[model samples]
Target: MNLETLKQGRNYCKSLTLNDRKILEEMLEDDFYIKFHELFRYMIDEDLKLEQEWFG
Candidate 1:
């Protein structure tokens, strides 16, 4: 997973209106939510690891 892509996705999410965010939150509660959440977390963790390796 590309960190830049993740950052872009996060920026897009942050740009959403309150109602849009609420709708997205509801959608995320569906059956695939756990898998999606896991994948997102993995990507973030991987990105953080890479940043630490590069900067430390």
Candidate 2:
């Protein structure tokens, strides 16, 4: 959770290819998709709150 690590994760996500995304989409289907989406959404919300608290 430092800036460098977050930047690296962003870079890695940006590097994902179309095939990678398709594979990910296929993997996260149905009930699994709903659960994972919620978890991912929560992570993003928490990250936003942390950034606002620390940087703003």
RMSD of each candidate relative to the true structure: 9.8, 9.9
Q: lDDT tens string, model 2, 2-53?
A: 5344444542333334565454456456566664554334344334212323
TM-score of 2: 0.31
* Model 2 worst lDDT window (10 residues): 47-56
List candidate 1 segments past 4 Å from native. Answer: 1-4, 8-14, 38-56
List candidate 2 segments past 4 Å from native. 1-8, 11-14, 30-56
lDDT of 1 by residue, 11-50 (tens): 2332344564454456457766655655445443443222
Per-residue error for 45 in candidate 2, Å, reads: 14
